[model samples]
Target: MEETISLQDLFKTLKKRLALILTCMILGVTIAGVVSYLLMTPTYQSSTQILVNQTQQEQDQFTSQEIQTNLQLINTYNVIIKSPAILDLVIERLTLDMTPGQLTQHITVASEQDSQVVNVTVKDPDPHRAADIANTTAEVFEEEIPKLMNVDNVNILSPAIVGDNPQPVDPNPPLNMAIGAVIGLMIGVGIAFLLEYLDTSIKGERDVEEILDLPILGLISPIPESDVNLDNVVRTRRKRR
Candidate 1:
């Protein structure tokens, strides 16, 4: 026969092993807090914007063909902005230690649907460095694109500026700790039930009857030593009488 557990039994099991569950949850939260606060590195983000148009007059010359051409070329421009040709100049101007590919990996170029603005974002461990990278990448692209594409379409819309209190974009300690605590609680509950299932020692009359397949005749009450001594004295008095 299959064993079925009810809500009352489940609650009893959890109640019996509440200490283990609580301990696991507390340990998990402590470890998560320490790791999030002390071990994880924070990352800061900064972004700059660049405007893309065929020419100052191209806005008046809006057509399906012109839009398609511009969209197709935008991907090429995105690639070129992160290329060695542009990033090398940016490195030279900023005197950065990183290689072109390393700098490129930190940068991201994005454009909106049917919009002429391209947003360039950079992430780094330092806020100021992130801002500098963003601004420098934009400026370098602005200067290089006009010469390479032979069109003065790229213009700096907004330069990346240092934020007053820039926040880290990564290593959300509170969120991480909360998630760890939840996982730990689940693990603790699982372990508690597993131990309860593995326990074979009988603690109740029902367990004893079920395991041994015998009816309990009677239960013996334990007598205290003081009571036994008083009974012995009473018996000796009766004998002397």
Candidate 2:
């Protein structure tokens, strides 16, 4: 016999396994929260801004061509800021124990469209060191760009700083917990449906009829205790006679 389930059966399956589903969700959230907050190392980020402007601007007059040229140069400056030529100097100055390529992994360079400003963001486990790396990279680039391109165009605009208390930017606890909850819910629902699908036991009259593909002729009721005792007594009297 071919067996198929209805919507009512599906709902019943989920409801019957509701406790297991809730347990999975709660367990997922708890584990994610613990890993994010206590087990994983957090990274702090700091950013510094550098301006690429023409050093020899005429007195009180800035030309549109000069502004456009600076805007175009911002992209080149963004690339150079993360290059080994710049990062090597930053490493030497800070005495950081990492190669230029490894240092590049901790730094990001970005520039706004049609703007002459570039932002260098650095992330590290230590907040103060992150700020120091951002500021030093900007300073080293400011000093080196003139020699590299034979133009004094780079200038530090805003330096990164660490306050008395700094916060980590990575391994966000709430976001991790939310993701875990969604994944756990999906797993729980899937498991509930899977268990239901794999079940093959007959549970009631409807299930028996569906499995056997036959109609029930009649129902048998259990005999009462008093009636059974009276029948036994009659049997005993007949036997004695």
Candidate 3:
């Protein structure tokens, strides 16, 4: 025979283990908050934009093919921007103590689909350093692309600048805490169910019937000690009085 539980049993289990569940949840949230707010390092981001255009700006009107050509070129330009050819110069200009690969890890190159604009973003512990890396990468890429690709199409659209208060781009506390709380709740519920399953000792008449697989004839009541010992009962009553 298969065993099954109903809504009443589920609610009863939760109620029985409510203390353990609450403790686990509170502990999980507390640990997550502490790690998110104090232990993890905050990373700030800065972005610089570069515009890709053809050299023949004298043409008052650019055709659809001309715009599409520039957009296609932007893809090649994106790869080159993060390449060693550009990153080497950026690292040298900034005097950063890292290899091209390491520098590339902190930088992100993005451009909208079918658009002539590229955005270069850098992440660092120092906001000013992030901005400097972004600006210098854009500058170095601007100078190097014309020589490497033999075309002068890339132009600096906007340079990065640090604001008075730049917020970090990572380690969101509320989100982390919420996730931790959910995991803790699942663990707690699992433990409660495991304990309930493991408990096989008979608890009442219903349990006895379930275990023995027999109908309960009746319940046997125990005789009170006072009824068997009248003198002791009288003495106990007098003492209570």
User: Once superposed on the true structure, which residue ranges of model 2 sit more than 4 Å away at CA?
Assistant: 1-3, 54-72, 215-241
lDDT of 1 by residue, 49-98 (tens): 98886664545567788778788888788888889999999899889998
**TM-score for each model:** 0.80, 0.82, 0.85
Q: RMSD to the native, candidate 1?
A: 3.8
Tens digits of per-residue lDDT for model 3 on 88-176? Answer: 98888889999999999999999967677899999998999999999999998888886898998788999999998899988889999
The lDDT of each candidate is: 0.87, 0.89, 0.89
Preferred candidate (TM-score higher): 1 or 3: 3
Model 2 C-alpha lDDT per residue in residues 1-241, reported as the tens digit of each score: 7778789988899899998899889988998999998999999999999887766745686688877766667878888888999999999999999999999999999996667788999999999999999999999998998898899877899999898888899989999999999888888999988887788887777877987899978767879999999999999999999
Candidate 3, residue 75: Cα displacement in angstroms equals 1.3
Q: Top model by TM-score, which number?
A: 3
Clashing pairs in 2: none
Q: Give the range of the ten consecutive residues with the poorest summed lDDT in model 2.
A: 53-62
Candidate 3 residue-wise lDDT at 44: 94
